[model samples]
Target: MIDPLQIDDILASGGALSKYFSSYEERGDQIEMSKLVLQGYEENMAEVIEAGTGIGKSFGYLVPAILHYEETREKTVVATSTITLQKQLVDKDLPTLMKALGKDIPFALLMGRSNYLCLRRYLDNTVSQSIFASDPTSEDGKLATWVRTTEDGILDELQALPRGVLKSDIASDFELCLGQKCPNFSRCFFFKSRKKAESAGIIVTNHHLLFLDAKKRCDNDEDYTEKALLPPYNRLIIDECHNMDKNATSLFTQVFSYYGFLWEYRKLVAVKHGANASNLITLAAGIVKGKENEALDVIKELESAEKIINNLNSILVMSLSGSEQRVDKSNYSFFLSKYSASLIAIKQSLDKITSLLNSIIGKTAFSDEDSYIQQGINSAICTFEGYSSFISEFLNIKEFKDKVYYLTREKNKNREEVQLKISPLEVSDILRESIFEKLDSVICLSATLKVDREFDFFRNQVGLDQREILSGCFESPFDYKKNLLLLIDNGKVLYKNNQESLYFDHAAEKIISAVRASGGGALVLFTSYKMLEYVSSKALSELAGFNILIQNGELSRSQLLKRFRDDKDSVLFATQSFWEGVDIPGDSLRLLILTKLPYPQVNEPLFKSRCEKLESEGESSFMMLSVPSMIMKLKQGLGRLIRSKDDKGVAYILDGRMNRSREYFLSQLPPCNCPDDFLDESLERRIEDFLY
Candidate 1:
């Protein structure tokens, strides 16, 4: 029976791992920050933790939450950005804390449904020959046979098999899940995981699932959805709080694909085969036509309309590609236009059907809600509810509608060859009310929270009210000045400062110079995938005898990390995913080259919307979305360099914006009392000097 004061003593004593891990200087400010966070959780108030480098932030907060959970027997939901931290907590950190405290609490890992194998999909492939055409006796089919005999249904277990044979061959979307009606429901791994999670005292999940649940709850009041799986809990602790807005935005946006539509259309045709074959086939043809596709069954007209849609989709993909500058040219504009038009037509068709259904609804003498009339109401409502809003948004972008067209690939059975439009934008207010407002307590914790020394930018974008915001800063346990050389070059060759080609070559050269100087333990980070690819292609043959790991160079994160660790002379060129969540302790990573400050693409649909909203409030969108996000990411990248006390490294900001920008990113960044001469332009040798 330990007392609260003793608990405080344990924290002060630095627990068991303290001796092995780096020591944190217990400053008054840091202690106060830790206290505030603990109090906030106790009082059920929203809190933001901006723990800077050297502040033992992870354990500082983890200790209190663990203590609270132990006392009350309540669950503490810890959400992290990467699988690595999730593994760390489950395997390392939590165990150390538990052993120190002599307490064993229940915990469970909750992940997306896709992470688990679909028993139904596996069973169907085994039982049905008509469903999948290839001979079951063949090599591929023989492998499927082996899977049925020895399938554990865990994603990690499945990975042991040949790569393409696993996820590539088998998957069942939730909509197609058939629930209890499915024969394999009793043996589904997803359900088994959910059952365990529902009962566990402490649940660990990623931010993606949390946001997915919140959005799914608002959109569909269904139990099998993301929100329904969440066990009733009083408090929520978001670990990678910086990514909340970006993840939430992605959750709310709906995207329709040409391949998906075509597949569904074919399925519908297949189901109504034989006597109905000719008419259905004709209707499907019309559905492929641009103007003819107005009605779901308008065969000739749909065929003509689909042609027009395909034409527009092609143009839009090309035009939008020019603006966003990512490799995958997902013609989002084409989808928006065609879907909007289709929605209008769908509504009209459904409206006519509704009139007929209403006439026969009660006349059929069906009283149950699932009856014909109720069924009519149920299905038709999905089409009519948001029809007007989608149409209005579409009409507003009428000018870009002309550019919408299809990008088709030749003989690609695996991929949806027909490129479709999608709306990639932020959905803040919706997420805030749906998830944040409903939760009793919301805790957003991260190493990088305060950008330019203020949480207002992140707080606003995440839809948290300023008055409700309670923030704290826990300084890290590492010595930043001694371990890190903060290098900010005032070079004119930056992405925003010059032509695309000019900046690429300039950035590539700088990266080469850093790699050569460091003898290669470096990570060249890029905001855009295109830039990463460009720099990678240029560096590939140029930086020979050095292991160059590029983002898209057929290497998984784990693979790249292994390669980098194996070779002292190696550099990893990475983009969005690698910008953060990378942990290279010691001298494995000695330098970080940030190609540009990460800012939300202005052309992205959600970005445009947020920008307008900010403009209405007389605030700069760049400050709200751009600067804060960049600062958090920059801090994350910087933190990756000096993972432990012994690790020494340099972080180079190639983009002059970090130096020129009016202290927005710097003020919010981790306070590193860098040497006065470190940022000197004349001290060209300083970077090399620090490396040694």
Candidate 2:
């Protein structure tokens, strides 16, 4: 086993990290956590850690991880929740660590295959492409030029193009890829990336891919395991570990969306002189005898399948009758009973289409001249099989009582349609069987994984066995009492049970006043889009003189944040995605207004089903699940207030429920000043004086 003292010395005040990072400050908490991670790996046990913000948690794990890899030459996989952090590790942290250590350690950044460009698809689109060649400035022309000069063929490398252009036109589609049989197989970007990852000592990836890999491993099929996306690894480290349950649940769940069906359908049917599945089928038929009849039959079956899908969708929309409430299953349980016959018909049509496509491919034996066309047919078959499998899961409701099934509406090119979706109520068993049991050692780390200084909530949610796993919590090095203030609303008038509009108006008034008192540098967070819209409209008109940036249709998250940071006196209004992963420090952000307590929307089918299952198991769903979950979210929001030692801010909770849940919420927060009457004129004046 590696010496714990050696690890500590490396992370000490005079260690390599401090020497490398000019702004780095040595913290005892970071060192302690590093030692614990090393100890866990040595003992071959799982570890759960909640390291507070500014704890330098990345280095704490990376140092130990690198040392372990070098000493044992074992592959260590690090999975993060968001692309922002994943890039940070690959582009910043790992490079800096390697530089400090002065060692040539091989590391690779692995993303989903869909993220890379497919050479075959790209060439097909640009081979003497006449679609937009007449105009050099057209989107298609520019895309064709980019395809020629690009090296890595990763979507992110092309910043000059629109987001979905590559995904739609050139990105690798698993169903369409010909693998080793393709002429471009020697230059495939996805395979090249996989090869690099296989040989690297450390692999960096996201939570979605890692969980998907685990799910495949749990199938216990040797063929599937051998052909798995990722190389073999026994040690794993998951950052933002709180999202693991949700990520795992999503991976295990299945859904068949209207847009997905339409996407596959468009690929097969020729549209506006474009090459499609039918043309490819005909091309293949010239090379193989009797294949023409089989191809024609498959095309006819697909056309019929498309008609049935459209008919079923029309019936579903008509039954809903533009009632938005029908989208939430908790509000409308009659959907299944009313449309059972149509659902069955749709399922049968899908099965028939899948069988027809499979049979066509099974009978074809084309020469090299038809290899490309054969690849397209194989791709269509794979898509059909996926559709059939998803439909089977949706129709077989009896197999999964803990699963929630629902229909939701979406718009595509001004046309509205409904989609069927399903999710597991709890993924504890899935995680245990798929991920935990297959790993020799696992480390779960996050900033908000603990509530009331306990890991029970996190452990239960993540399916971590207490007897086998070690857990710890580390406080932030920053002095929160000196730099932060948490305030709860004492004004009962804010929660008068008025109409939502009236309540929003009242909330808007408070928000405006707070932003004005702080002279801007405020982040107003809302729980829902409706509330955000109402508050944004009211505040925009009321606070006209201030620079207001709202997170909506106008700008992206990164763009909005950039504008917020550039202007010192700016108020940014945002919802869900802004609750966490936002970092604003110093005087640029002096106030944070939480419109309401962060609570799981009970109407959401997944949350409702999970609560019901917990109740059936003789558990207090509110205490065991709801409260802890909200507390963690509250902690995440609060952590956003004080990012550094010099940063000072005031966090205002506008909800009146904070009074009843004061003990539970406040105990999880930083130093707070809860006055008896914050709405009083004198109290308001006092708050202004204190904050300003």
Candidate 3:
């Protein structure tokens, strides 16, 4: 298929990249990675590669991808972990690639089904704004204009929904959409994007949507080849592959949030004062007059549902008396026995509500206009059915050799809540069967996919350990040793997870001093909110002269990042989410801090379940799961610094256990400077000296 491996002519000294840029430093690793990708496509198997920063791994895969598409005319779905990367590919990289290629390639970006505006739902909810926003000064007027003119009705284009509208009222939803039976079938934004994507050879999507395609194919095997979620694709490229397992676990995890479960009924029947505050079932009853008896029946069911939900949640909150617990089949049987009466009552209520709605739908099926109402009612039926089904499945856990059952608590202003959940102990086998094996070829590449210079941890975690696959590790071309310096606490912050008072004071003082010396451009990462809050309290008072932002503050992540990035002298203290995907490539981010090593919380139910499984298999769960996992995350934190060749930064690890795991740390990361001694008061001065 067009000689997929013949790439030297395009990537050599006078090749496409060199001619495209006036001062391009060709990276050999990039070419090598491109070859590895091409080999994967040629051989029709999985290829796992760990390419370091500055390797331009995107282009490495893109060049081969374009060649393969040209030869085979087979679609390739590229899945990324973050929306930031998806935007980068579609908005930035693709244009540059197009310019370099001297032509356009057929490509499209598709998000999950719920991201686009459901024209049917939007119109059904807001009639005027959905059609003619003639009052040009109004928000609805603007939205109407957007609705008429926008190519893809993605929520990303709009800043906010109307003041009274819920996202579900306007955006695409799984529970909604009657497919071709709807009046707006041809014009539906999600299906329009899907249809548009069918023409493109390359499609870009995020990990959730990618796995959703897999799950849909698995759950709907009779229609497996029908392009259920994504178009049929022969080859797949997964960037940010290190996050695959985490994302897969989240995708597979089933949860019934107690509050959310209660809110479904509230949305249906709760009436409150204010414009448009009357719930949907109330408004629907008014719209379709003459269904008074059925509407009354719906009301009675909702009242019963609310009481049962409160009792169910009360049972969980009172019985557990802890934040989390791992449950066995016996526990499931216990819960089933405890909640069986309440569960059956709620089911009866939900079933009654569903039946009434279905009856209304049956009577309102005259015209396409009338049918939108029926469709919305149908959607409500699905939601109620889904809620009932999930509760049933959660308590009805049976024969769970591959899954973990658990319960969790969330504290709020009014209620102590619990969430019942079931997560896969390991997503490796699930992913191997559901996604990788189904595809003709797969390329999983990331900057931090390996542990101790080997893909053993990642491969085994993703169920590719025994698969016939090609793997490689490509080091970054940048002079990390020259550009980035790593400083350890030497013994000042004696954090052995004990002597808590001593560790907090010393670590906080060190963090404050470093940020002060840097004059505010620092990202101090912590493993827990408790520590983040403790240090932020100390810093906010001590470092009052500088702009300081803390994680879980009043601002959103994007807002905090904007302030941190735009103001060159702002320090942002954040937790796990900020460790990666932070690309501040300038002098503003010359200092990074990690207060503690990131080890999985041993008490968390999912982590405990996985560790127990590993232990049962006669493996050292801490050595195999904990250490490698910590190292990968450590590498991610370090990679946040020196994102580009021009950027120079210093990172500090303030935990004493870091020295204990020195061997694993040294073997896992790239070559960087780590001066042995910093046990004294000169650490702050050293950071300033290095930066200035």
**Local distance difference test scores for all models:** 0.61, 0.76, 0.79
Question: Per-residue lDDT tens digits of candidate 3, residues 1-692?
Answer: 55533576567678876899888777888888998899899889899999998999888898888888888888888999988898888878877877987757788899998788888656646544343468756777877777788888877766545556656556776654677877788888888788878988889999988887887787777233467678878799999999998998999888776567554664465453346556556556666777767777777777777778778888888888667887775576776777778777777777878888776545543454344345456666888888778767765666766888788987643468878788888888877877777777889999998876678899888877767889998998878888888887776457655677688888889898888888878999999887888888998999988898887746767778888999888899999899888888897788899988888888788888788888999999999999888888988998888888898888988887778767667767888888776654888788878888
Shift of residue 559 alpha carbon in model 3, Å: 1.6
Give the lDDT of residue 445 in candidate 2.
98
Model 1 Cα lDDT, one tens digit per residue, 598-665: 76667554455556656777988776766666667777777778787788888887876666753545
* 226-344: candidate 2 lDDT, tens digit per residue: 54777888889999998888778877776666667767766665422355423665555546656678768767866777777788777767765432322233433465566666667
Q: Which ranges of candidate 2 are over 4 A from the true structure?
A: 126-152, 156-166, 221-227, 270-278, 285-304, 314-337, 411-416, 494-498, 672-677, 680-691
Candidate 2 lDDT: 0.76
lDDT measured at residue 645 in model 3 versus the true structure, 0 to 100 = 85
Off by over 4 Å in 3: 1-6, 123-151, 157-165, 178-187, 222-226, 266-291, 310-323, 329-348, 355-366, 396-400, 410-417, 491-501
Output the TM-score of candidate 1. 0.75
Higher-lDDT candidate among 2 and 3? 3
Query: By lDDT, who's the top model here?
Result: 3
lDDT score, residue 139, model 3?
72
Clashing residue pairs found in predicted model 2: none
